[model samples]
Target: MAASSTATIGSYELTSRAIYEPPAAAVREGSRILDETRRLGSRYGEDYSDGGVESVAAQNASAELAESWKYPRQNVFRTGAAFWSLLTSGANDAAYGALIPYLEEYYNLSYIIVSLVFLSPFVGYILAAVLNNTLHRRIGQRGIGITCGICHILAYIIIAVHPPYPVLVLAYCLAGFGNGISDAAWNAWIGNLDRANETLGFLHAFYGVGGVISPLIATNMIAKADLPWYTFYYVMIGLATIELVSCTWAFWPNGPEVYRQTMDASNEDNQGMKEALFKLPFARVTWLCAAFLLCYVGVEVSVCGWIVQFMIRVRKAENYPAGMTSMGFWLGLAVGRAVLGFVTPLLGVKVAVSVKILARLLEGSLAAFGGSGAAILPFAVGAIAQAKGVKTLQPIILAFLTALLGLWLCLPRIGRKQD
Candidate 1:
């Protein structure tokens, strides 16, 4: 298993390294998701909080027990809608990142203030994490989806109008909150679906699709289009409006609020969340997963978020063409996820003989899809930035270097022989 394979993109060897381990029992036993969750649930399932498998099993059943949710059309619609929702969010994620430099100019603010636009979304994710269980049980996932759609709508409207800086920040924060709830609920719902892994893959793939398209559109608007710079947000408003209708159609279920997984009382669910949070082993694993993701997202967001500025500053590339650099990175990500997903199972994890590669790429294509593509390609472009100039590529190089370091630190065992 030569984990390192160099595919050429022009002169450079796009040498991605990977160590491919087969799936474990949990993933291997695909159809047994609920049964397996039940078995795990019977023991310490209640300790697995945040609307995941660790519940009291309201009727000795999982969230999959809701009969009203079993409509074939509805299932397909829900999954499709979720995919679109992710796509829309993905677009916003990258668009805003690309927009950062523009935002700084428009708001006449320092980096910290402009950066708040990104931080505000976390406010939504945190609130969603805290209230996901209670809210879903109360308002139904459909309601949350609709709310998320509206939040996006309102947020885009505010941005399009070019309100005062404080107002812009508040609007972004609101959108982030919606984004958080929608993301949590839809993922949880999809996790309970048939062919859950593949469905989840699709959901994220669309996210990459959004990521790829966002910069292409946003760059043209701000850097090239004769339309107002705010025109990009006007397009977003249209998309968000369509998303609202789609969510309502997919999730509303003929106006019935039928999303409670069971008839269990509310207090019991709270106790389940508490127990999950308090348990040492579960809490430890949970936090580790969180830390890994924090690093992963930090890389993804940082690279996608900053690449446009990188190109402008370092390469002195034209704004319109520079946008393509970010677009290419996300395109690689989306393609990596889709292509490698179909191929990883074909080969076992192997080693590559060459210069040291990034640890995550050596982990495999599935690994690359997560956020590796987001950081790798654009940053690689940054590496060459100095060659054209006298060493202007430092920012891009340093940024990706930090990403690789984060992956290495988080997963020290990657690409290493197990003793």
Candidate 2:
């Protein structure tokens, strides 16, 4: 009886031990299954709501990884589309600079009258800025591509037909809206990618490339081939057509539903532009950037737009050589963007900017100085030019440089220590 009880107890003890401790192979298999479960959960997890212990399993899944050119194979095509859009914009913009002289002659107008083309575009640009977010939310990037393409094609067709002065001005407004949309959308898209600085630098370089090539083609068509000014736009129509096709195809998958899903996964898109502009520290940065770019673009456009005329009128240069000067300017800009993209990261942004500022100051103290005064200078310089002739270009440019210095002094204080 004692032996029987002992044996039964031993059997019970063994059974209990087997139940408490799983076999090594079973343990390994179970761990493997758990790991896969976690992987899947993370991969498809909902927005990681912090629900204490329950959220631990999904903590790694909620991260928003930066997109790259490789991961989404389609990004390569999208980027190419973006580059081409900017290229079109560059060509369009540079053409105005090269054709300004021809436009004045064709319309039998003074500088003030011909300058209306430049002013009219601002109306389109302002509207584009206001409507950009709404368009993105409603139709997504696909719509943007289609809409901008239509705008460009329609505008170029109108310009090619050599419409009346008022009609021509209207056409440029349409073109400006298209350029603004592409500019804003593509910049935002590429900026969110990995190595944004280098990418954006290269992107702008394409703009410069367009700038470089446009004047060369426009000048030759007019001076060498003896083609009409309107004929230049025929080339633009073809390029815009390509832009429409590439952009539409590349972003076809990025519809409103896809955009909404992506936005829902990230909280960053929740803030409105008004909120973003008014949000303390960020506001200061935003306003500063806006002001600086306004100045920089003003300087760039003013120089590029007027340089051909200046070369012809002020410098007494022939048609072909005057146009080539603008080509040289754009070439320098393109080279800088391509080369400095690699160099800037190593030098650091702040240091690079400082170096650029220093170099700019040395080369031409007032070369890029600009402000609201500069913006209004078309009217101002027009009046002065009437009284003083084209020689007023020098004085007006000098005045802008002075205004720029004053504007710099009056800029919103950022990062400077208060007394």
Candidate 3:
């Protein structure tokens, strides 16, 4: 009886040990499954078809493994997933930002609260940047994305119910954190593509789609029907759900394996990524890229956030009209992204990504800087009219308007005629 009890305890310990590390037989089986891939990767690299029998055998073995693993056509799936995810992201932004004022009014929002809401997301970005690779390495891209989706689900639901000011602040923080994680993950996933710039352009074009359409839905309901602004969160809930499901479905079962394979193939010759980055001109170029994106986003988001008020107060427009003005700006963004996507491949991905980023910085900076000047310029124009004892500023307004109109109407025609 004592010997039987001893055997039972021994069996229980073996089972627990297998749960953590598996038996050596199972480990060997896993290793053998990837042995051909390692051999191929180590010997002839990712593309080793030099008409050699050994390489041919390795290739066939790797192909069979890929087929059994359910990731036969790797390149096609991820790009499509990224495009849809970005579209959802863009939609969420429009729905939420369009009703900021109503949100403020309902929550009795203070400037400090607003500052916290904006700041919390950056904190999340920092967290994701630090932790993303490690977590992705452990749990796969889909795992990271699933957590991001859960954050969104919690965040929007909290906002939809019009939670207390402190709770709302917490919700926005959650929203920002979720956004940061997904954004980093998507960028990492898509950045590795051969046609990175072209795919990125298409991805952002969907962002423009959301930016344009989401606002229309929000404004029509809020400005026209006077529906409670919190109602917009339902639209976001729907969008976030779609994003979550699409990403989950696309990356399931084999995403981590594929990532490992891709990373191994890509990194074979470059020493290490860190070593290469610290080497000369590449480091400098990386810093410049980072700086440009920082300034570009600051200017872009600021303009998008405030332009509605500018139109409403300065142009004396009603809420619906002011909202439409924002939609027009977003529509232009969408159109530009779609058109520029074609241009990306022609320029080469590296040059194209840099130049496009610079162009956006230039475009957004000029608009913001010029808009600020325009805001002050009109008052100065009015002051001159007042000083001259002109009863009406209409003549001055008309003269400026006529010159602007002439510029708008004639420049394109002259350019076409020159062509």
Candidate 4:
């Protein structure tokens, strides 16, 4: 009886040991699963174990990790999305050119009055610059963007309804105000993004696209007489509405402002905003930007705004219709800006800008002397050379001339930096 009892006890003990001890295969699989879970949790923070620990070091680490995950992803999406929004918004400016004829015909506006209508926006631009930093700080980038969108829509509506000439000027001013606000605010926002210089070029490229499309659409609508001239304003109003919605939804919580503040604080710690604006570094950059902007706008406005008149009255170029000339100019501008997008990075901003300015001067000189065909040749050559590289001394000379001109403009505000 004692021997039998002892055997039963031994058998029970063996069974219990086998049940508790897992097989080698099962143990290896479990370990691998645990390791994978730990690695993934570290990589993506999916595991809450470390996150739940109540320590200051752990909290700081988690916060940093969260920020790292958020900004890169957000910036990637925002850069492209913002570019599209800006493009659509800017395209509406093409309507300004179409309005010239209407104002001349319906309002009996003299050349001075018409010119003022074109120039009034600059006033708004100047005013917006004065108020931009403060307004952005008070309202945040997204809020300011929404406000600009609203103002833009309203301005378009006012113009579309054929307000009196004074009121029309006011409407144009308001549109300019919207544009200036958006330009300053959104540019600052984009500059705050990672890879700012590259992203900024892309963002501006969209503006170029918008500028191209605007004239085409405006000219087409007018040519068709599909609706009253004022109806074009409605189209713009609709675009502004879309911009408002986009600003509100896609760019909310205002992360851009925080970035802007950080950047501004770091860069301008000792300087007042106004003082900062006039400082050598700031002045140098601004002078370059201004020169680029001025020459670009002058060339673009002349081509789109006056080309039709020039063609019909001056050159009498073949296939030149009232609208066709403007269309061609817009197409050229769009293509030029698109090509510049890729070319600018390669050449660097200073060189790319010098090239553009040189092209403008050459085109202007050619137009003055040899008429349209000769002017077109310089532009065409410059565009091709941008991609193909200059093979001859002529392009090299032109490029040198452009650099000299840019330096001339830049030297007054800021002395040349030491090599």
Best by TM-score: 2
| Global lDDT scores for all candidate models | 0.61, 0.72, 0.58, 0.56
Clashes of each: 9, 0, 0, 0
User: Which of candidates 1 and 4 reaches a greater TM-score?
Assistant: 1
TM-score of each: 0.67, 0.74, 0.64, 0.63
- The lDDT leader among the candidates is 2
Candidate 2: count of backbone clashes, pairs at least 3 residues apart or interchain: 0
lDDT string, candidate 2, 1-419, tens digits: 99999999999999997886667776666666555444333343222122113354355434234365544689999999989998998888778779989998999988877777766667667667667667877888998899889999999999999999999999998998888778777776775565666887888899889999999999999999999999999999999999999999998888877766766764445463444367775455445545555555656666777788888999999999999999998899888987876776575444434333222111111111212212344544555566777677776677666766766775544332321
What TM-score would you give candidate 1 relative to the actual structure?
0.67
Q: Candidate 1: which stretches are off by over 4 Å?
A: 1-71, 254-257, 263-276, 339-419
Mark the 10 consecutive residues where model 4 has the least summed lDDT.
366-375
Error of 4 at 388 (Å): 41
Flag regions of model 3 displaced more than 4 Å: 1-78, 110-112, 255-257, 264-272, 275-277, 348-419
| Ten contiguous residues with the weakest lDDT in model 2 | 361-370
lDDT by residue (256-348, candidate 4, tens digit) is: 576467647556433533342476664565445544454444445534554443344445553225656665565666666556546554644
Stretches off by above 4 angstroms in model 4 are 1-71, 255-285, 315-320, 347-419
Candidate 1 vs candidate 3: which has greater lDDT? 1
Residue-level lDDT for 331 in candidate 2? 93
Q: Residue 58: error of model 1 in Å?
A: 26
Kindly indicate the candidate among 1 and 2 with the higher TM-score: 2
